[model samples]
Target: MTAVMEPGMDAVETDAASSPYQGYVYAYPHKTAYRPLPDRPGLRGLWAGEPQRALSLYIHIPFCEIRCGFCNLFTRIGSPEGLTTAYLDALDRQATAVRAALDGDARFSVAAFGGGTPTYLTAAELTRLFDIAEQRMGADLRAVPLSVEASPDTATADRLAVLAERGTTRLSLGVQSFLDEEARSAVRPQKRAAVEEALGRVRAAGFPVLNIDLIYGIDGQTVASWLRSLDAALAWQPEELYLYPLYVRPLTGLGRRGAEDAGHDPAWDAQRLTLYRAGRDHLLAAGYRQVSMRMFRRTDAPDTGGGDHSCQTDGMVGLGCGARSYTSRLHYSFDYAVDARQVRGIIDDYVATTDFTRAEVGRHLTGDEPRRRHLLQSLLQADGLELAGYRQRFGSTPAEDFPAELAAFAARGWLAEGDADRLALTPEGLAHADAVGPALFSAAVRADMAAYELK
Candidate 1:
């Protein structure tokens, strides 16, 4: 199985859109088996020729004190016997292997630590992880956008100082909802005061960016209550705010308990829209700008205008189990088993070499692979690919490649043509992004179906 053909390949499949070599659509193996699995359209390649200077890296720490019912992230409740320490050791090994694979003096422009809670690591573990990153990837430890995800409970002043010392400028605090009842129903026990304290400490530590993660349409979440939460978040004035509407996953506790009623459905969806509209208005009024579907920022950050292209365009190297990495033409991710033995096995594989074979790439990105790639790239920033950049990389025009779909989206006010090189999704598009994100998976799923047939 060779790489998928670009427009120039004469062997282009006539029914590429309908091709059978799509990506896997099952639940990400490491996440909660209790929630419904979200659609994941995989990528085409794995090993890019060589590492580039503008790369990004995301490291996952899949450990949490208590697993939230709504969370599908790979995590376990306070694994004893020092599993966290073991995971850190495993991560350092994986980093070394990844460095070997990268093959050159590669420097990363952005690095983000996301997980059950990266702050769960002890200060020593965190420092060691950063040391591995600095030594291996030559990552710009002093970059402006170095971000990490932390829960309120784990984000102590000590942790803030540790992060600041490590050149971490951004902190994404998971606040979920301000309502205590809503928080309890969602199984997130962190108190609102804790979130505020964490934010205050991080800001006082001089971290440049503070982003809060908020959710609307949770069980017992009414529009009025949702507005109050927003008001509370606004009072803190985080540098950025990311809003997510809760989606039910069949494999999560919420799913087993039929938790869709918590934050999904048209009515809940409408409430979220109202929240966004009001929230966007409020943020913009407060002088913040919309950058992506769920992202808004203060004027200080680069005017990506809501698009965080650095992650997608340059590609990212992910550390930690169940983390996904993307390169110029490939996306690779490994699963982490919750059980101790499986965790060790996966970690061993990480330390060992990973040969992303042609068959694997074929299974992820083939058939209508290019278009799906285009969509993912565009959606990341709520803006379409730069035409010149796209041509330089993928060698085709999206309008020419997916004429009907693009035209239909534009007609429905979900998309708009930007400069010849740019395509930006409209406000309408942002409102229904969740649904459309799955549409982008069409090609991936179709390819998966084809693969299933072959099997």
Candidate 2:
């Protein structure tokens, strides 16, 4: 079907349709804007005075077999000899220091391994990765929900088995497209049969939840083709499906090509919108429900954010150079790098450093940024935000805290005054999530992000 006007395609959708691609506001106050901390705050103080909130741990694996054309995450295409081992060793040291800094009564309810591709490691390396997390952080993989990100090419049987035995609750695979051409256009080299094999392996491994990821807006994609890929994934009956809109960013393979090709096309935006609606409607009909704009899950699947994630209140403990640790007022990580040489240099520096007890680079949230963060995270969910809950946490209603912004959303008919004092997205509002999320960022943060150079 051709892309066309639909309900909720108001001025915002019109705006999206006119622009090249609405920026993906994954995390508010983009990491690009983060500056270095000269004092390099120590972890003991950050973790000691912290409230008794359940904590989530994130372990980053910065190695991948191939860098996709549309990818811009902090990871390298390949690992050199002994690089993985060195990286793991550094992780062990960081975790030990970080754990020592934490209060003894700290509780961990969930853990995740994310990166270029956690599955890129050998089975033995994978086991060691867990060792650092479990031994250093005292996070028992068997007790809490554990999630790991992987790619189809590297999800070997050995790695899958190790993950299963170690009690990984969720295994997410990036099967961007079933069509070989689409996959090629995205600069991800993989065969249909290989992806099928990987899926079968992951399922046989018996992780409670299996999430398959698909991308909708590649260089060459259409309504029928998008459905073909979606239908293929649904046939697998994955517990979760993440529909990602292809984003071309600077320093990415696709970004360079996109620069040379058609610079900006609103028509592409409309096509993506049409495809998104088709996919969302199809998933709902197939007994899957939306958790967020990008996330859908089978009705029978346990809550995606079942543990500490459900509270959505936990701060994350990040290990590895690409990881970011968070606190109530701050978020910090090692400097970020997209260039291969610089990334290697940063990784080498991290591995060589003896001091792993403190954070060296970060940004502090001020004014109502914390409140804004809570609202942004909550409002983006399909469940919406509760006014009483907001008041209880921040002592202010969403309407009062975000008076002008909420009013605009309500006036546009994108937001609804739901039952029990909840504010939710109308069908159209959810469609424009990419735009809405960025609109909520504070002026100062935006300015900081604009000024800072994204490595």
Candidate 3:
């Protein structure tokens, strides 16, 4: 880590402040912060008194045909014979138990299937998965904005047909790159022909929204090459596009390359920032509006799916072992694992188990933590946080509760007050979100997350 000599700060303090690529803060209080709950909390207690009545359902399919080099998600490679069938059976049992826990009053307005790759299941298996949501839970997949993640290799025509038949509004395909060399550089091992074929099939599937995910900053990737990817994605006229910067994390294939090359280099950081600007500007010119730092949606794309449920505060029910269920009080899931062997062991444990209800491992949030989460989630968006709405919910403004944090950002030219009741980040500030996010992490949460052991 490089040290920055900040004015009025000692070397040690500055060094801690300047560490690059600390960690990606997608969800508040990172999953690594959770610990095993010896007395697993039943769903009733977890959801009891949660103000929000409507819920979003997240179903995880942890099987993937291929594992990428930089992937650190909770998933494993292809399952052995009969494992898929058994997994489905267990998933149904869990779903049934969870549905009963929710009671008749609780409603599901949004549903999604995400994973190593949701399309990893066969067309018939996909049918069974939908049946659990529709028949068992009464959350009509046809009525909600259902999204499913897939990869080019696994999104077969038959599978796409099944998804189309079952009311899938959005189909997200992880087309990391258009260049064959870059794919090889990232150890993703995909060809241009295959990606194009997958794109064609997804479009033919007739989902209301098509999201294409592309990655930049791979080894040997250049500004010109990044624009080529942008241009290629634009050719698809996708409803949404997400550009992700490459991150190498522990236990990943690329993480084991060498000690010297382990973390983000100063040179690589500069390159990624430049390429991010290029991609952002290109998308803007192509009539796509930035949603968050990474997400961009077509200006005229249909927003007919996924009702106005905000993931920041809404309750979510997660069915699969890898899936995480979130309540106002806690976020819980099965034990997380990254290593292939460790993940396999955990999967084995999950399959052999008969109990399909309650939270096994999770972290309970303190009162202040929820307020901080509200700030982090709202502040990171392009639209910024609404000061009035925040004050109405929490009885205090963000500026009042987190004065030092907001002042520090403002002093650094990263923050801007807009339209009287809103606060937003300048483009430069959004570029530094990774740095700012970690700074906002409570010391206690960070310590717990750091101390947790990975299986």
Candidate 4:
């Protein structure tokens, strides 16, 4: 059993040695807020230079059975079935548009159906989606690992079979916490039997991997309770586990129930770290490899091994509304704008000419104003840069361009030297990857922030 520190005491000190605020850390301003930047004219040059095939697809079905309190997905709550019907058609049309843009290239390494819950769709709806995706992209749905996100309530046996038949090898079940009280308090009221039944059904259906997501650091959750949740979750034998630390976001339900409002411990931040460390230790002992900061997988699991699963870095092509694609040429995202009228417009655009482009690609990628582009990709994953790859892509070496920055990280025990090619990040570096990227591009971020302040 995990032990909880006393209520009045500090679980861990927030001094310079242990806090996240230390170091010559760079902070990245929100990339989402910037207006579409001008497109680069030499995108074709970048594509020809980097002929890496699109390895994955992320299709966002933004409709949930019920909106969870902490969820920030781009979804509409309690949307009518008629709206869903319309949305499915839009998804197919959108896929055609994207495929047309790809110029008939359809071989993707992985495809993920993520959302509020892809299983929210009826069997027929899902089948139709798969059929359309295959037809348009010439996608080998059967060959690649297809992952679908679902909740316990929707992962019924029949639905699992339907998904299995549709070539989905992976299922991501959102089981935030096993403790009923904690789950309910967090507004994710999951039933024990339902979770069990769903896991059994999905596993029985021969899903290659069953990943269960768990949340720790919720208010009223102690180390003991969190451990109990972990124990119960392990009992289910999930192939992978994703543990996330809860953070407050503006306008979220949990955010409004602030630390001050919740009459409990010394402070929320103090409790958060304790729960995080405890959960990490427990999962590590249970033979789960910490794949990323918030993700873990069984060490011996064949399908979902210790590697990056997020589409952002893995050459993924996104379909459906609000789905984003990071290609060799440019990064493009589609949103079925919130209004039904805007949705109709996007659908019409898709039907009229099966392809489209946006100006954001140019704005984000173009122009050589001595751009100090941060290595957001390397920073997000603990994976170190291929020094040769960097030089070949940008025609500059890290040591030559930013020696002081590299030295600063090395001084902090976060950097490890590699043989003439890779400058690796140690485990400590992985834990704080998000913070390091900003420092790498400090000049650009600071200038952007300063501009924001002036405005």
Candidate 5:
């Protein structure tokens, strides 16, 4: 792997070798890799020759009731006196501009409202949000699958009602732990009683799919306690479950408390891996199927039927201060930050701006980036990447383009055996997903990410 280095690849490989938990590669070429686009290309020009149908629509709400210790997402702690209203007004304006830029041929196959917490808004505000998506952006929420994220406190009856009425196919609740002590240890500060009440409300709301998120490897968290949390969530019989490892990154509450190097601790890594395997086997025995390293679904759960839009190849229209829009050639978003003050500053600028028609900060996908992204995202899934599809799209096989990396994985016993038509990972390989994801980073992206200063 070192011999095939392209200037900046060594740093990432070294980091991955130090710890199996580097970072979560939810999206390739992370926001840290994005820089100011000097050309500031017009959105119309960006979309003129691109396909518009079957696009994914994303609306980001950057306000959360409270900031958890392990959280480093782009969001503010709370909305000031008029901040929520002002933010919604800005969202409406941005939606109008984006809709016009699409030139009337845009159609959304799926939509999601993520954040901080989209349910942080009042019921009336949520209604206005749906109206903006439908009336201004021309996205018919009822015609597509919509997913929304919520915290326990914000999953009120009124809010849940509005979500159910407006066609929310999936409601994901972030219940990091079932034990009160564990929740406090994770800096989530939620009571078990409140979480139960929230889950009951979500079930009463009658959404087709309910997803519960849990966390493993918290301080003082033992294997027995981890199983308790998993069993607690299983009582809900949720359609989906996302088990996330606790990552204490820079600027987060845990990091500020001097726990930034927690992931590098060998003991901590072993604890997380042990807990992850326990949770995985527990779910599999309970009749659930693994979708990815973090996601699992009940075998009998109803299919929400929004598989038309593929994140690997389709375009995405994102609206908000923290949202990101993806085109085949570029991925763009507003300036990103994790510090509370810097995040607030960016939100203020987003609200004050009138011209939302040009790209401000972005990264262009050039050379073999598209291929790397396709392989990275697909191979991470439980089904893995199909060999024929790779050949059809790029006119080259993964083994041919990434001989050294593939050989390294095989030597490490990460590659699954006897799967000639698909490139998949072994069970142990899936356990080290965080490491595998970072190891595949392009040199240019790694360099840019290394250079980015975390405000």
Candidate 6:
């Protein structure tokens, strides 16, 4: 499929047509665009006028048992003596300050614990983390849909018990592959037996949703192996599944090993696309519905409801050094890095910090950025964007605001034919979600991301 670029469109739209796996667009104006806030605006002032009724709460833990080859996340391997304790102490302090800043008006509609791995902590430590969220941040986990991430090794029975007892609605386990060789090839060393045991334990704990995450395009992975992994996960009858395409990014172990060459290889792209379609079809045939490019939910899965918290408009309060907080106009966080040494340094600085009242590093959303964010986040979902909602929010339709981009997408056959009420992606468009997403990035954001210096 060829994407004919409209005269005024950015070059990224052209690149999107050729390279379908450019990058994952999980969030707009990613952390790479953030800069030091010289004025260090107070958190209270940032949240004063922002709506807090349906806020989302997030807590980040930066320690992991081992670093995977394809990982470029801001995390370190292993917590040294007293490191976890100090980190928790800092988390508590930050939560206290942020809660005070919200001025007693905030109410969380959903919450999440993500990281390196939230379950890397001991069962008792998990209890303490929950207490801090409930006590200091005033997030009632029991009342909200609480999601947590876990790894196969850390999803122990005790940890699962603690998570279930504390009202965790979803537990997402990173089981990249069911085959041990493929797991090792991806630098995630785990046996199939252990993964199965962990899955059994998670099911026994009775969480509302069990999400198994698998990665396609791993070294030596073929269509058959990918299906095997998918079938293995299906055998467990998980409520959700996330199939991620392997990305060998700079600063990650795979990048250091020169594995990034495969990312640019046309043959590799074809292989990944083939594998993605096979897996997508298999899941759809097995009674799972596509939620996004990466997420698939079982048709009969229990709905853990928190529909009020909209990522495009709702405010989010993030605690922990690795977490990012979002208000209507600004997104803020502490320093971010993928290098091990730099990550440890940031964590140490976070632990030793006393005050948490001001925004240190962030980007302020301005003008059309909010509209772009709303459009980008909404369009990527399988449900697509409601034109009426967009018009109601911005007083302009997407067609009026983004005619050229929409035309370019239509040229590439990435857009679905829809009535005036909705705009959505075609199946091929969802397959190339990474490409479609980056193409929509604003020019200023792209420049900011490009200029970021990696540590």
Q: What is the TM-score of each candidate against the true structure?
A: 0.80, 0.93, 0.94, 0.78, 0.96, 0.96
RMSD to truth, every model: 8.2, 4.7, 4.9, 7.1, 4.3, 4.4
- Candidate 3 C-alpha lDDT tens digits along 201-314: 988888999998898889999999989988988999999998887777667667657522534477777887798889999999999998777889999999866675787778
Roughly what TM-score does model 5 have, to 2 decimal places? 0.96
Candidate 4 per-residue C-alpha lDDT over 305-388 given as tens digits, one digit per residue, 9 for 90 to 100 = 322333333444667655655544355554324233444454344334333433222224443222234344444454556677
CA lDDT of each candidate? 0.61, 0.79, 0.79, 0.59, 0.87, 0.87
* Candidate 5 lDDT over residue span 354-425, tens digit each: 999999999999998998899898988888999998899899999998887788788888889897899998
lDDT of 3 at 437: 69
Tens-digit per-residue lDDT, 1-455, candidate 1: 00000000011122312221122121111121112214332222245464466677778776677767666555555666767776777777667667766647666766778776788888878887788778865676775368888888888888778898998877788888877888997777767777677778877887777788887657777768877888888887778887765655434557568763433255555666676677777777877878776678876654222224354356667777667666554455665343434554664554453433211211233455645665565654655466776667667777777777666667668776546667767777666554444445453353433333100
RMSD of 2: 4.7
Off by over 4 Å in 4: 1-31, 34-52, 258-267, 304-315, 335-363, 367-374, 402-405, 417-421, 437-455
Could you tell me the lDDT of residue 360 within candidate 3?
A: 92
* Model 3 lDDT, residue 15, Cα: 27
For model 1, the stretches where C-alpha displacement exceeds 4 angstroms are 1-48, 260-264, 300-309, 336-364, 417-421, 444-455
State the weakest 10-residue window (summed lDDT) of model 5: 1-10
Cα-lDDT of candidate 3: 0.79
Q: Which stretches of candidate 5 lie over 4 Å from their true place?
A: 1-15
Residues 304-345, candidate 6: write the lDDT tens digits.
997489998898889999889999989999998888999999
Provide the clashing-pair count of each candidate structure. 19, 0, 0, 7, 0, 0
